[model samples]
Target: MDRMPRWADVILIPLISLILAALLSALVILFIGESPIEAIKLMISGALGSTYGWGYTLYYATNFMFTGLAVSVAFHARMFNIGGEGQALLGGLGVAVVLVYIPWPHWTIALLAATASAAAFGAAWAALPAYLQARRGSHIVITTIMFNFIAAALLNWALVGPMKAPGQEPATVSFPEATNLPTLHDIFGIIGIDWSRAAPANVSLFVAIAACVAVWALIWRTRLGYEIRAFGYSEPAARYAGISPFKIIMVAMLISGGLAGCMAINNVQGEAERLVLNAAEGAGFIGIAVALMGRSHPLGVFLAALLFGFLYQGGAELALWMNIQRELIVVIQALVILFTGALDNMIRMPLEKIFLAARRKSPPPPGPDRKSTSAEAAE
Candidate 1:
């Protein structure tokens, strides 16, 4: 079979992307009259040099992981989802509403309810565009982006007009104690480790990794995942093979939007959480680049999320150290997107040739005709 080697295509693309992103971002740093080496050193020191920094990095990674996974899931079905921010916002709102309204006194039940509520809202949010695309043949990119804006505006109105906390200066209301996600301190006592001191980057990081594992297993081992991949590679081919493109697209969006919903549980579920005006604070848009850089693979998305998380945390440190605008991080991130997007072909050609040559060298299995004739003659 002259099939292209998938692994060869997958591994090299993102590796080349990171290398190019780094080199290009370094150039941008220098062009801005900053020492890229010093900037990067300070960033690494700030992001991973201490326990406190590691905690923040872990927290940042959590957000990236969820958004990245959301974007990647849709991409697997060849659907480009730009609605992560909106979906996540709705998810957060769902949890907030449930936390405020649901009067569960038990801590565990409240937490579970909040998380599940958020996911459900995300599914609903994404369903609109999915329905339009699936049933009415709307362009997903346009519809999803419009919905993202709509979600942001609605969130602002809700926060300021209806859900506003009494006598509070911020736009958000207070969540009940039961709704708060328990910290590591609530569950375990690590010797010499103060879990209470960690940032709001919640325990959702572990959950994200678990989700990644499940996604990997789902895509590689299940029939549904096979259909998704088939659609991604060739929608017409998938339909010709008896797979329903509309159903697959809907499933992909639901799962993708659901992942963003999980981010709401992780980010804005507990105490001091509320809808603080419009916009997803840019997490939704960042997810597009993250998914592209990850090649829409679970493992790739995890690593890409980690790298994006590092840039975010370390870039903040770099800003503080150099007394510069924090927007410098945004510049670096944009460069990453540029390079990562170029990776589709940049890293594929050579590896594809190498793998193809190797495959050609291996002799093919006996054909059915040859096997039948051999057995007949032997008998």
Candidate 2:
């Protein structure tokens, strides 16, 4: 039997973890001689107050959504794919190559091409790690980490040498106007809604939402998802049932890599309109925390990504208005991640015990016993 209701396990534990992290973060802010309440107010106003703020928040969330989904897919196969940063980087390269080399007549066509290219590059980058882990027993975590560094080096070399724009900067040329995607503001304008300011938030936010729906459907409503989850739960049992571990690992990691790579569509094609160095910007690592906090579900991943997005935008505001250091913002983020990920058991175990004890003590539901009822009637 479950120690607690699924609802409590899914929502309450993570909520408490977030509250605890917030308390610790509040103390840190107080220690720095700042008002935590005021800081929070500033953060809220900066990140959620205006449509412009929301635009940036949504933009950041879009990046997290893709990477979080990547992690979630890998988790379903009992694999820890930590190379999202590298995969996303390669995906960006793919987008740049597609946009620059091919002349598409419309944004829709460009978007489709860029997305496929990005997914391919990201999947290809992940294939080797998946192969190594499945065939040679190389740890997925270690291989993915190493691959991140290799990807960075390779991107650097390409950017500066062959793919470099004809300039001192190590970035490709800006994409053509035809390939530029419409921003949220443009979309809203068609419906007679006014977005107050311009933000990098673009059509990719819709794509991210669509991705979430697709992942949920794939994970919960398909035979492949069942096999993947079965493998994740027990490799021995999966093997006994004739499931191929190698195929599961490869497929899961490839899907993960593809999802991670799709983030390039948001940051590169949608926003930057060019491939830039360090574009992934630690979002890959952040995706780990997101996956943990979200419990590797698509819905959870979406919510967690939004929360982190708020943190990123809000932290910027706090730093600008409250004189908080950039490192402190990082510390706050670290606390959230630490509590939600590393210390999850600290919260979960106690909740489980409490729920189990309560369940034990609760009166059992009355049985439909005809004998007992007849006896009572006789008395």
Candidate 3:
């Protein structure tokens, strides 16, 4: 049997990354003329102030969670997908188109239609890059990055022209109230909180959690995932093993792009309550950082996304109290990615030594020693 990187060591990489990110965040606070302790305190209080704040944090985390998992899935297949931002934007556009054209459909029907449309659009948007990687040997980084720009421009053009809401100031078409996702309070029917103070804890959180489980199953159990991992190891090896790299690319990009689109339901349908041009809010890009920090593990990415989600939802309160710019959170996210990527190999040191020692103790190749030839010549 061949050796593989130990699973446990893989889990520790993100834990170290997060500790470093927190320390860097504190340094940011000190630089901005505020007590690090005070600033952190404000972040905690604001993010968890009450049931309402917690709900909002969960809502934001839902989108991030989906994006992070999408990126992680691609990473597991040894592909770097940079177009999550665009895939998500295209997904958002699909929702807008469905809402505008559909004629007063029931909420359940609308939900299904919107979800299926978003997935189809996202998969289509990603398919071209997948094709290039499969047939033309194009680098995913270049293709996906270029595609992201194209998606953004196309989305903006559509929103400002053909998809524009009639007589509206914003560059968006609002979904009909009936087609919109139900708020936590409205659908849950456990109300009586102040409207201003309380927000609808978007149902998308559950969807995000469920997506994680699905990813875990896919990565650990499915034949498609097995082939993707084979390609990840080496293309030649995968070919020798009868796995098709081209097919793997298509499957990986489809799931990755679909998840990117699915992430928007958390925002366009649940958070923003309106179809907006910038609904992605860079969550797709940040998801790369999250996936890297988590070392592409499903649970690790989940926790990492929630941690960043904490920073995001708490940024304003921290900024005011700590006299720092909100953009500091971006810096912290970068630091996490850097440290995690840098330390990945180092984190494997212990397991590497163990495997090496085990190899040394094993038997050699199935052949007799060559010393007899030299002895016979001497005789």
Candidate models: Cα lDDT each = 0.75, 0.87, 0.75
For residues 1-379, what per-residue lDDT tens digits would candidate 2 score against the true structure? Answer: 4456656767898889889978888898999899999989998999999988888889999999999999989988878889999999999999999999999999999999999999999999999999999999999999999999999999999888888899888999999999999998999989998985577889999899999999888877888887888888889999999999999999999999999999999999998999878878888878887887788888889999999888888988887898686466567667767887678789889998988788789864565233312111111
Tens-place lDDT per residue, model 3, 1-379, is 3343333345544566677778887886787678888777888888777666666667767777878888887876788888999999998887777877776567778777777888788888889998999899999889999999999899888878877777755457567778767666664565665422366456677778888889877876788776776677677998999998888888998899998888777777666656677779888988888777666766767887787778886886666666677888788877877777665566456556766677689864565344312111111
TM-score of each: 0.86, 0.94, 0.86
Error of 2 at 108 (Å): 0.2
Report the C-alpha displacement of residue 232, candidate 2, in angstroms. 0.3
Candidate 3 wrong stretches, greater than 4 Å: 1-8, 167-170, 187-197, 346-379
What is the alpha-carbon lDDT of model 3 when measured against the actual structure? 0.75
lDDT of 2 at 240: 100
Tell me how far candidate 1 lies from the true structure as C-alpha RMSD in angstroms: 6.8
